[model samples]
Target: MKVYILWHVHHVAVDEVGNVAHFENGEFSARENLGDDVKLLGVYSTPDRVERRISVARTLPGFRDEPDCFWSAEVEVDEDDWASGYVTE
Candidate 1:
């Protein structure tokens, strides 16, 4: 079985001192033991951030984990004209 993992970073900043430029681009990886049944397809950030979402999937282990999954994908974003700040509502 094959699964897809989608991850994103919102706000792009953690604090007033932090900026979007400091945020890492993106990264993904997989973990599996030799002949291990349990498998994990993990997508994570190279540089940890305050806001991050990780989705996991179960699939057969592969020789290479860094496959290009974002090829020919379209993304849409909403623009409300807001500052990069912590919001709780």
Candidate 2:
């Protein structure tokens, strides 16, 4: 099934948003991963739930600063995410 993954930067810069998304996408190797600096809000079953989470998150501290920093991507579960190996660099 398709699921929505939510992630937010922890006092990270705007330029790092894409990097975090890429990390979540499993595009970067373990050594180059930026997952540590990001806060995973939660995985949701639908985008609507993700949006609701964003709305609620925006009201919390720290999250208000990067209000739009919330990055979400739809992914399938129990599926072969990578048919082949990934490369970093």
**Predictions in order: lDDT:** 0.28, 0.72
Q: Compared to the true structure, candidate 1 yields what TM-score?
A: 0.19
Q: What total of clashing residue pairs does each candidate reach?
A: 0, 0
- lDDT tens per residue, model 1, 31-53: 12212122223433332221122
Top model by lDDT, which number? 2
lDDT for model 2, on a 0 to 1 scale? 0.72
Which residue ranges in model 1 land beyond 4 Å of their true spot? 14-17, 21-89
The number of the candidate with the highest TM-score is: 2
The sequence of per-residue lDDT tens digits that candidate 2 reaches over residues 11-77 is 3322344443323354421221433357889999999999999999999999897676677889999
